[model samples]
Target: MSGDDAQQHIYKTHGLLLNPIMCGVCGWQFYTLGIYNAHQWMQYGERPHAFRCHAQYL
Candidate 1:
């Protein structure tokens, strides 16, 4: 299936809402907490202060 179709299937199968958690710094929305955490780790490494926005806002 196409990427959009696969994503729709997963969301439907898991009963997930489309309202994702958005990053204040980059305006990127995360569908899951795990993915959000992973993005933070990959983007800013272990340093929380390195982020342009506050962690509490995330």
Candidate 2:
């Protein structure tokens, strides 16, 4: 498989365990979706949401 496909597969496979309100890099968990999204926005500036949880790229 292509690198992109492999990465997508891994993300999909671990998506659930890595809760939407949790940080994949730091294990930080937020209380609500609002809070989580807010944090993501603050860190990632409203784009490339897929990287928010581990948004060092931003």
Q: Which candidate should be chosen as best, given TM-score against the real structure?
A: 1
Task: Give me the candidate number with maximum lDDT.
Answer: 1
Evaluate all candidate structures by whole-model CA lDDT and list the values in order. Answer: 0.61, 0.54
**Model 1 whole-model lDDT (C-alpha atoms):** 0.61
Per-residue lDDT of model 2, residues 19-51, tens digit only:
335766556786444456567666756743443
Cα lDDT over the full model 2: 0.54
**Candidate 2 Cα deviation (angstroms), residue 13:** 28
RMSD to true structure for each model, in Å: 10.6, 7.8
Off by over 4 Å in 2: 1-20, 47-58
lDDT of 1 by residue, 1-58 (tens): 9655565566668855356767766879899655766777666664333232545432
Candidate 2 lDDT at 27 equals 62
User: Which 10-residue window in model 1 sums to the lowest lDDT?
Assistant: 49-58
